[model samples]
Each structure stands twice: as structure tokens, then as C-alpha cells.
Target: MRFSVMDLKVGDRTGSDVFNWNGLLVVSANTVLNADDIDKLQRHDIDYVDIMLRYDGKSPEEKPAAAIPQENETARTYEEAVGGIKLLFQQMLQEGKISKELVDQSFAPLANHIEQEKDVVSLLLTLNNKDDYTYQHSVQVGMISYYIAKWMGKSEEEAVFVGKAGYLHDIGKSRIDNNLLQKPGRLTADEFSQVKRHTEYGYEMIMKSQLPEPIALVALQHHERLDGSGYPNALRSQDIHPFSKIVAVADIYSAMISNRVYQQKQDLLRVLKELHQLSFGKLDAKITQVFIRHMIPNFIGKKVLLNTGESGIIIMTHPTDFFRPLIQINNQFINLSDHHELEIQEIYMR
Candidate 1:
């Protein structure tokens, strides 16, 4: 039977082989459990395992998993925050307007947790949802923006505010036609123009709602580029607000990794490379560098598929060359920086 790790007793045997989220063998079938084994499983973040059960009317005490307290609490917090955001969007669409109270409510539940999270990028990557892309994208952007703000040494309060701003940045998309928003093909020039208007729509909504000025600016300037290449205002580097710079990095990173109606999710490494390119003249170079340097290292220990069709676990990342990391393929180790021709094709997440 499938059982949460906490449900397994010290002497419990595995009924079936247990694998981790990456499809790696965690525990073999028929292996007896012990305290140490359970501890190891917890360290690997294995939430559940299949256990052999006796047909007799006897069982061990039903205890909770030792790891569940904090990690599961974080998961629950994120779920509640996403649900709140979803409802906030629904209300905005129905009413054709937003309120400061509703915007604050959408961001408040996740504030404390976002402040405490050390590696928000990894957490956000793990929590990414392919379904309900829009709502989840907003939540992920908020969490990521909070991390970037903190990385830039912003105060706790400022980081939280930036996160709230990120959450509401795309609220203007609520006014856009749902069919057009989710079309699974290339948009014509007219449709593209409609999509670009989300910035103005979102900006006006936040401004009218009486929210903080910076939050409204983030909505307005998120699509504005540093090189005068972005949409709407097309403001250059000096014209854009710092808050918008942070959100732009977060928004681009989150959207590239996320599956959209018209596009499949891009590889994380590839997305990071593109961000590096954009950082040169289009994006905030300092902010983008800070994001890539801190966030790329978290990919270590993650399983990945390579361009050569081989799958491996990331072992180490280069300090300067963020894209290529040392990976363990079978019993062999290959440093991607040394093998210039090969590249990471995809990253597997659970």
C-alpha cells in the first residue's frame, strides 16, 4: 500500500520499490525500514513510499513524518497563497476592477514564508504548475522577486513589498479576452498589440485601487526595456524603476520556465543563458547577474537530460560559466564546460 513516510514503522517492509520525484531508486522493494533509513528518506524529501502490510488486523502506531512539520507547512502556505491569488483574479475579472484590500489579501499570506525562504528559486521551481499557468505564474514571480530583492540586500519590508508588487503586476491581463490570452498559436500583430496593452490596463487598475505607487509602477514598467526595445512606453534603462527591473527579471525567468498555451517550457539552463544575453543592454545587468549567480547553483543535485540523450544528475556548477555544470552520467563524470558541444536539454522537476 502507498504510505507516507511517517506511516511506516521501524520494522515495516517495502511492498514495492520506492523512487524519488526524479525517478531514481530511493528504497528497494522488501527492504526493512529503520530509524536511520527513515532519516535518510526524510533528507531526500521523499514524501511517501509503498509499504508491505500484514493482512492481520495489526499495525504500528500512526505517526506523522518528522520532516512534515516545516516543509509541509511551507507547501500548505504556498497552496493557500495561490488559491487566494486565483480568487482575487476571478473577482477582478467579474467586477472589472481591483481593490487595494483584495490585492493586499492576495499577497499577505505568502509574505512571512517568502521572507524566511533561503532558496526561493529552488522552491519556486519545485512548486511550478503547468496547469493554471496564469495564477501560478503570478505567485512564482512574487516569490522569485522577493528573493531577488533580498539578494540585492533590500530590507525585509522592502522585499515583501516587491513581492506583493510582483503578484499584482499582471492583474491587467484579467481584462484581456480569455480566448486571446490562451490561444495556442502565434498571435497576429493585432492580437499581439492587445496582449501588450495588459501593461497599461494593469497599471491603471493598480493606480485606481489606491495601492502603493511603486506597485503600480511595477505593473506599468514590467514590460518596459532598458534598450528601448520593450512594449508600451519603451522606456530606456534610466527611466524604469528599480522595482520594475527586479520584477522584469523575475517575470522573464518564471515565464520562460513555465509551460504556456502556445509554447512548451524551455530548459532552465537555456533560459538563464537568454537572460544573460538580455542583461547586456535590455535588462538590468546588476540585477540579472545577481539572480543568475545565486540561482544557478541550486540546480546541483538535480537530475537533467543532456543534448546527447543521456540523463544525469548535476554534480557541480562553474562559478563563471553558469550554464555548464559537472554532471554524473552513470559511473562517469563529465564537466559540461569541458564538453562545449554537449548541452543540457532539459531539467526534470517534481
Candidate 2:
């Protein structure tokens, strides 16, 4: 079986001799690898190698199975995209500048996946990592932004632009102190004040990179709310760029549904309810409507835990009661619209 170097376990034995792109032998066959060897292989760009199957003391027909190809590929794709994002941030922090080409390269897979699949929820479900919140959040915002723009009937070029803007929106946070960013408790006023500067820092970085005017404005204005309730500038309504408005909605939605340093992830139904409330005064109502309309239906086939300690699969969505859906549990169908006492406690990913 062939496995990417990143997916190798410490006890996995090599099925073939490992070689570099230059065709020189690196490690002989049948060598047991440890953490250090796996890390070295990844650092040296030795992406994949054939691995021998576990040979228990049994008959040949009872050989241990290899990793599932589809599952491995899915895991690899996700890892590579995230690793690229992390590397991009690391490079930017070290160099004190943003690289437009590198940013494009880092975000290409996500953009391509969203463009090809046309389903943002599935992609969002794949990005549930809590350890790398910043990088994952950036990617999620970018992907959600792309879908929102596309759903709102924006041109393909315009949608892609907003997606790119979403991906790079939080680059400014890379400059903030890790202690402040990763604090497990609520930040003090002074710490929060410093945190807010990420917007200005991001704006400066994007502008300095000569990327695009809209992308720079997105970094600057994404935090600004319709009611002038946001930070850095607090420009409201017509003042905020439209692209930034799109990104703002995406950013809020992504953040609310994601696990972060200070909070656990919220249930999707609950997050949507909060977004609906925010739309009245804080977010753009039109964009919020378009987003809600497109997003709620995607939950039809998903599974959710109820507040009553029961789990079920969503079978149908109520048209007006967007949050209440009919569910199937133990061969019984329950319409949540009729069961006012019940609510979704958690959304399970596929």
C-alpha cells in the first residue's frame, strides 16, 4: 500500500526503498520508521511511499488490509491545503510581507473544490479542526465567501475575487502576539485593543502587496458593521465596500460555526438564528437573506442531536420555520415544527 509521508504511522514498514526526486536511495526497504523519520520525509518533499502490510502470524489469505484509497486521498487533500495555509502564514511572518502568488497557490485547491462541487456546506463540514483555528477559519471564510457571492448572482470573476479576499482577510492576525491570540480566557480590554489592530495590520499588508484595491478594502472593512458597531474604522452602511460587506457576513458565519480559542463551536441552527438577528441591524439584510435561503436547505440530509438527548437524521426542512426540520429516528418521523419543545443541540458532520 502507498501512503503519503504525512499519513505514515510510526510502526509502518516501508514496502519499497525510498528515493528522492533525483532518484537516489534515501531509506532501504522493510525499515521501520519513527516520528523523526516521517517528519524528515515530509520536510524533504518525499510525499508518498509504498508501505508493507502488517504480517501477523496467520495464513496468506488473512493479510491485514491496506488504507482505503478514497479516504486516504480525502485526508491528504485536506492536509495539504491546510499545511499550505500554515506555511504561507509562517513565511509572511518571517519575511514581513505578503506574497500574492503564494496566497493564490495556497488557496487554489479550496477555490477549485468549491467551484467544482458547488456545495459549500460539505466543504465547511470538512474543516472542523480546532487546533489550527486561524488557518482553518481563513480558509472557511474564503470558501463561504465564494459560495455567498455565487449564490447572490455575482459574476464568476467577482465571486472568485471575494473568495480570495476572504482567504486573505485575516492575514493581519499573523502579526498579533500568539499569547493574545491563543488566550483560553476572555481577553482584557488592553489585550482586545491590541487584537483589533489586526484589521489595520491586515489592511496594510494587503495594500503593500499590490494585490487589489477590493481585497485590501475587504481586510480593512470586514469588521465594520452596518450600524457602525465594529472596530478599527466603524464605517457603516454605504461607507463599507460591497465586497467587504459580503466578506463580513461570511466571516461572522464562519467564526460562529467554528471552534475557536475562546469558545466552542455553536450549533448551525443556533448560529443561523443569531445571524438572522444580526442581519436586522448589524449585517446587510439582503446578503443575509440570500445566504440563509441557500444554506438552510443543505441541512436536509444531515444528522443532528436534539436538546432532548436524542439523535436523528433530517428528512425535510420546514419552509417558513427554517430552523425546524422533520427528522427520522428509529423508523419514526417527527416534525420539529410541531414539537416546539425540541431544538437542535448539535449538527453532526459526515
Candidate 3:
């Protein structure tokens, strides 16, 4: 079967791919669908249907092979796992004993789930739904760090360890008071000091647990800068572990993109710009370049409205100048770097 984006109405059977009553993706096989699942699909504006047929255990010869609807299974599963991790942290804060069984039971499955789908962008985007900043930030860092590790050609085991370190990097923030953590104004010197304590607190918390030594080390060192400007410990570039360096970049990127109670979410392009600027002193220049070149490109698709009232789809991205990209509007290629008049005013994801 050929893949076609067609408006599907309820009860329409285009082929083996049956359009649900609500025009969501559904297979004609004997499986049950749920209300939440349908609602989630609708939220993403997946109203078009595409059908794919298999013959002799292979996809049928079709010119336009169906574009598979991006599955949120990996995302959903990762979110659930992060939720469990959050719960464990909450329990720990309450002085409740963290059982090794619970930690293994929760993280082991999450590790396996992340391993199945190596696409880190989808994983990070999926985990962004969490309303809580700490939990969402943790998952984002994990996914981003995992992607960085993979890009560096690290082994699967090393990548997973990097991911685990990222996930637990901010566990010490659990001890910080909610008022200070969620404050909307600039923090006072004392408040900033308290905020800085999270690194040490997270390190101590992880040290007490059954997690591996490298994971705990990452929690402590993620804040340390290459120029000895980072917090908890002013370790220089050589003093910092490679995993910590990876986590540091991921953590800063996620924090910059995320909307906190005190601060609005920074523009995606602007955040990348800031990261690039800071790469010289704080972040690893090579990894920062990799993140900007590879990871940042994934968030830039979908249509955008230019400041000149021209709208278009982002066609190309620049590694060094992330804020600028070539746009296709009305069948014309407008390069933002050259056409300074045409600036992206807003992005429309549909």
C-alpha cells in the first residue's frame, strides 16, 4: 500500500489501516485502543491516515511507502519510568528507605525501553510533558546525554551509564525548599548558595544508594566548569570526568529551554546561541558543536512565521548560526542569513 496523507473520518477503512471514529491512527487487527491513547494522538494533530501492507514478510512494493506515524511508545514509557524515579526521590526526601529492589525494578525496564528506540530527540520531546521542572529536566538531560554519548561512539553500556548519570544528576534538588526552587524572581546570594547545595546534596544522596560510582560522580561534577568556574567544586577541564562534562552540557541546554516558575522558556534558537557562546569557557567546545549541529536541528522543523509576515517551512539549518535558517515560502527559498528582512517571528508545529 502507498502512504498518503488523507483526511480520514470516523469509521473509514482506507485499507488495513483503519481510521478510528475520531480519525486517529489504528490498525484493523484484533487489538483494543484506549481513550487516553486516542486523545494523545489527537493532541498531536494526527488526523491524516496512511496504510502499509506487508507481503511475504516484507513491505509491499509501493512508490510512496507509508510514513509510519511517530510512535510515542518510547516517550510514554520513558515518562512513566521518570515518574517512578521522581517518586523514589520523594520517598527518599521523607526519610523513607529506598529499596534496591524498587530502584532495579524501575530503572532496569527504563534502560531496556530506551535501548529499544535509539532516537534521543523523540525520547526528550516525549518526557517534556511532565509539569514538574525537576522530573522533566532530569529526563531531558538523560536523553540528551545519551545522544551525545552515542554521537561520540561510546559503547552501549557507556551510553546507558551516561543516561543514568544524567537522570539522577539533579536528585539533590529534592532537598531544596519549593519556594526557592520555584521562585520567579532573581535569587539572592543566600538563595543562590542554597541552590548550589543541590550538587553536593545530590552527590551525597546517590552515594548512599546502590547506584554505580560513576553515576554518583556525575551528579557531583556536572556543575563543574572546564575553567574552574562551576559550583560545588571548581574542578578544571582535566579534573572533570568525561561523563560529567556530557551531563553538564545537557543539563544547561535543558535548563535553558525549560520554562521555570521564575523564568519563561527561552527561545530554542536563542538557547543554542547562548550554549555556543558559553562553550569556550564552560562547556566542551567539540560536544557543544555536535549538539548544535546534530541535536538542535531536530527541533527546527515545522512551519514558521517570519517577522515580515511571510510564512514558510524551515528547509535548512546553519551549525554555527542556529538562529538563521533557509525558509521555503510560496515556492521561494529565503535564506535568513542573506535575507535579514525575513526573520522567524514564531514557529508553528503541526
Scored by TM-score, the top model is 1
Over the stretch 46-157, how does candidate 3's per-residue lDDT look in tens digits? 4544433322223333211122233555656676767877886886698633555666565556766655343244345445545788888887788778768866768878
Off by over 4 Å in 3: 1-70, 96-101, 115-129, 296-300, 307-310, 319-322, 341-348
RMSD of model 1 against the true structure? 10.3
Better of 1 and 3 by lDDT: 1
Ranking by TM-score: 1, 2, 3
Alpha-carbon lDDT of model 3:
0.67
- For every candidate in turn, the CA RMSD to the true structure comes to 10.3, 14.8, 9.6
- On lDDT, the leading prediction is 1
TM-score of each: 0.78, 0.77, 0.75
- What's the CA error at residue 67 for candidate 3, in Å? 7.6
Lowest lDDT 10-mer window, candidate 3?
28-37
Tens-place lDDT per residue, model 1, 1-350, is: 78888765665667876655544344556655655456546655788888875222254342222322456777787888788888777877777667767766767778886564444445765677548888889988898888788778788789989999998889889888989999999999999999989999888877777788899899899998999999788899999999999999999999999999988888887898999999999999999988876666556677899879999987766655768888899999998889999988888752
Q: Cα lDDT for residue 153, model 2?
A: 81
lDDT scores in order: 0.78, 0.76, 0.67
lDDT of 2 by residue, 74-156 (tens): 44555666777787678768876778788877777666655644234545665565468888788778888898898788877
